[model samples]
Target chain A: MQQIKKDFPIFKRTINGKPLVYLDNASTTQKPIVMLKVLENFYFTSNANIHRGIYTLSEEATDKYEAVRKKAAKFIGARTEEEIIFTKNTTEAINCVRVSWGEKNIKKGDEIVVSSLEHHANLVPWQELAKSKQAALKIIPLTNDYTLDAEAYKKLLSPKTKLVCLTVESNVTGTIVPVKQMTALAHAVGAKVMIDGAQSVGHIPTDVHNLNCDFFAFSAHKMLGPTGVGVLYVKQSLMEEMAPFMYGGEMVESVKATSATYRSGPWKFEAGTPNIAGVIAFGAAIDYLSNIGFKKIMAHEQELLAYAKKMLAKYPQVKIFSPSQKHAGGIISFAISGVHPHDIATIFNNEGIAIRSGLHCAEPLMNYLGVYGTARMSFYIYNTKKDIDTAEKALKKVLKTFKL
Target chain B: MDIYTETILDHYQHPHHTGALNDATVSATEHNPLCGDVIKLDLKIKNNVVEKIGFVGNGCAISQASISLLCDAVEGKKISSLKKLKPKDIYDLLGVTISPGRIKCALLGLSALQKALKLTKN
Candidate 1:
């Protein structure tokens, strides 16, 4: 774990005269030096537009860009590279599905089911879609312990349900939903399921085939890649059925003055000059994570989560919102009595420990949970027990500062 | 330097002029949706001068303390003088260098006060 910390240069820096203790992995992971080198080398040596120029540079660039698609497919257990469509970020990827597949399939009086654990990126799009189509948006409720009510989800599914969107892991509560079982239930009612893998892909083992989800969206930046690249994996058959989201440039098969037929496969959704360098470097990020292996990464993160929970348990003022260890991942969201999350975050910042505060882009969930916001500490492969100790000390400073 | 100074913490712990005015002539509320901080200001304006002022809300120390300080600064002052108050004045009142991220928290009180002023004018 200490060796892994060295791979990220940011960990070496000092903030407020203290060593940086970053616990905001769910927001965005720090870029590895390997990923940085790949991003820089791509721009330095192979800077060209893909699928446009007939020159060698463009062809090489296109090959590198497309290779990442195949790597992403293999990484997530997609059936083929043709299933992968590169978007700007996870939000854009979900919007792609909303515009292309949703507008066509979702009709008036239909139903769309999402969980109470959804980030705004997943919830708001579907809410807007339901509003535009005059459809009903249903929510899968949470148990008292914060895990999803799978029984309630089964009852919500019916023939009228056109789509079911589920997150593989909750960013705020750290609850890991049983997506495979839920997807099967959705498919039983002929509803297509889309999994938001933004918090799951790099942290846990993800297999689109095992989950049997029709569409999946994730951001590369959350998994140590550059900021501008994201992946949308549509099942191959659905890929053929969906229309192009953005219509321009290489996405077209042939252009005429009047009308044009779009390209087949994932290229249909990628319009304009895409983030070529970001895509190629995302491939390197995948390689770096693969080399470490998910088993080690998960073990490392789980250890940190357990340690953090144990440490936090010492303070009676602290209330944890994450599910039990068996049902959750590396995230630990909690609130200290009489202390606002923003105050907690400011105190942690003074100690050079980075944590997230506020609604976490899950306002509805926050309202449901009956807290205005929460202080979240998410762990990754590089985070150590010592980092958690630093955070614990900073948390003490928060209580002392506030006289809680 | 830590943005949370002793004065900020003191104001947060024991804020001045807090509560809803029963006969408030004008009132306005402002929310920082990013962190879910909300502040509501109530004024008892008489003859275009501030007769009394109070604030109530739930938020971080920066925001609560800011509103508390703002309430102290504006009471008994002329309405026109209150209009001249700027963000720098709030920072000066804070007695600490506020980061860009916390500037909104520091100025949330100013925002609500301005809105209340607008309501009174109308």
Candidate 2:
């Protein structure tokens, strides 16, 4: 197994005079040294605008910028480089799809399907689209164990359904959704499918082609890369059908007094100067993940999750929220009987252990689970069983201190 | 990382004046759906003054404890005077600067208080 801890410099620092045990990977993964170096090198050496400049520096910068697009294409198994459009983050990527595809295709009486497991980023855009287009927004309910009811989802789909947007892995429940099956069902109904891969991409292997999704969106920061860079993958055939979300320089073919011709899909969607350094660092993140091998990373996280669940089970006051014994992703969400999640998190913080407290961006799921909030501990390759042990110890101390 | 103060934790561990007031003239509930923090405030008013205050609901320790602190702060004060309380004032009482993300948690109690005060006027 790779020594995942060695790649991150932040782990070397002390928190509260103790070694930091970061369990907030679900919010944002810590950057690897490789990605940090790539960003530094870009600023120190090749910092210039792309596509419009005639200087050697601009050519080099453009080459590197476009190279990252190719890497992104390969990473998500996009058939062509033109299918990948870069944005500020996953929220921007999803908004682009809503504005472009949703605006043109969805009409009054049409329906868009979403699940309760969505982050606000996914839910709000669709709600706005539905309101503007006079379309209906349908939601798939979760099972008692917090898994999406696929059977219920099938019943929700109909000829009126224009699109289906779902998460690949839930940020709160940590449930690995059946994206392939869901995509197939949506496609069978002639409705397009968009997968939110924000929690899946680098944590697991993602192939857009194999998943047969119409669009896939993920952020670089959640995958050990820099922030402000995200990828949107549209299938080659669907790219032509989707309208441009933004129109500006570098995306026009020609201009006349009356009309202006726009460039093809991806470039046409990216409006202004992009986050060049963030994109270059994203490629470095991909390289680091590829070198370590995603399979090993998955295995390590699975082991950690199992150990965490087992250890947390010993706490009678604790209530775990995800489906039992499933190979869910690294997140573990639970609530203590008498202790509020914020209290648990604060006590853990004093111990130099970091965890997330709240709805984890899935407010609907929290409502369905009938809880105020939960304390979430998410793992990555750098996290180990020892980290889980530390979290458990800290949690026990909190429970006892609270006299729960 | 010290987003929560020691007093906040103490209040969380041992909440003060937590319950419901059956004879309350005003009552209201406020929730932060983003974090699933909920607080219900009940106040008994006499001659336009808050005679007693109570709260009951589920929330993070910060919110529950803050509500507990709020109960103590506004128990005998005039409703008009207590309505002027701001989130920063509450944070100052706790002696800590909360994270931007957690400001809602601290504000949950104050929001409930305001709503309950409005209810009493009605």
Candidate 3:
């Protein structure tokens, strides 16, 4: 992990002349040298637009760009490359599903179920869809221990349940949901399932086929890749059932003034000239993570999270929201009984420790948990136990300053 | 920890005037919805001078302390000069450099103060 930390230049710098202790990996993971080098290499060597030219450079660029779709497909265990649609980010990818699937299938009286723990990217779009189509947007509540309540989800399911949008892992509480069990229930009621993988893909091992989810959405930026590139996986069986979110040059096969024939498979979803370099480099990011292996990464993160948990236990005023270390991912959302999250975060920042404070884009979850906000510390592949120790030490200083 | 000095924490722990005034002439409120920090300002003005000031809120120590300081800053000052207050003044009053992320938290009180002054002026 020390060698891995060296690959990210951000760790080399000092914050306020103190060594930077970064624990905000859930917001966005810092890119490694390998990812950045490939990104630069693409712009320098193959800068041509994909699928637009017969020239050598364009051919090479298109091959590299499309190759990422293949890499992404295999990375997530999708049946084919045709199932992967590259978009701007996870938000855009989820919006693509809402635009293409929700607009077409959801109708008045139909119910779209979302879990208690969706990020706004997965929640708000469904709300808008329900508002537009007059569909019912239902929610699965969380248990007291932060796990998704299975009984509430069963009660929400009916023949009218058209879709169930869920997060594979919550960004705020770091609760790794049992998507397989929930998907089975949703399928019993003939509802399609979409998994939000923004906080899950890089942190946990995932297999789309084994999970049997109808769709999955994730971003490269959160998984050690460059920004502006994300992937949406549509089940091959559902491909013809949905329409494209946008229409432009690359998506259509042949067009007249009034009507056009669209391309089959994932290409139909992509409209514009894509982020060529970012997509190609995304393949490199997947390669980087795959080579390191998720087992190794998850083990390291669990150790860091356990160390954080132990450190936080020393402060009796602290109330942690995430359940147990085994049931959770590598995040810990907590509040020091009297001190607000913003102040804790500020104090942590002053000590050169970087953590996130706020509702973390899950305001509904914050309301559900009966908290204004919680200070969050998330770990990643590059994070070490020392970072957690520094964070804990800084938190003690924060407690002293607040007199809590 | 440049932002949370002893003076600020002192104000945070023992905040100076809190609660709404029943006889107040003007009042206003603002909140940082992202973190749920809220500040409400009530001002009692007599003859174009601020006779009394109070803030009611719950938030981070920075916001609570800053509002507590603002409570003392507005009293006995001419109402005309109150509207001219800026974030720089608050920073000067607190004697600490605020980072960009917590600027909203620090200025939430001043934001309500400016809004209350608008009503008090009329």
Pull out the clashing pairs in model 1: none
Interface DockQ of candidate 3: 0.80
Ranking by DockQ: 1, 3, 2
Candidate 1 regions exceeding 4 Å error are none
By descending lDDT, how would the candidates be arranged? 1, 3, 2
How accurate locally, in lDDT, is each candidate?
0.93, 0.87, 0.90
lDDT of 1 by residue, A190-228 (tens): 999989999999999899988899999999999999999
lDDT of 2 by residue, A1-404 (tens): 54778889999988788799999999999998989999999999999998889999899999999999999999888888889999999999999999888889999999999988898888989999999989999999988777889899999999999899999988887898989999999999999998999999989999998999998999999999999999999888888877878877787888888889888869988877999989988999999888888889888888888999899889888999877657389888999887778778878887889999877777777778888778999889899888888897898788777766
Give the per-residue lDDT digits (tens) of candidate 3, residues A1-404: 67898888888889877898889989999998889999999888778998889999999999999889999999999999999999999999999999888899899999999999999999999999999999999999999989999998999999999999999989999999999999999999999998999999998988998899998999999999999999999999998878989989999999999999999899999998998999998988999999999989988988888888888888789998888767899988998877889888878887788999989999999999998899999999888888887887888888887777
Candidate 3: docking tier: high
**Candidate 1: Cα lDDT at A77:** 97
TM-score of each model, paired residue for residue: 0.98, 0.92, 0.96
**What TM-score does structure 1 among the candidates reach?**
0.98
Name the runs in model 3 displaced over 4 angstroms. Answer: B45-47, B119-121
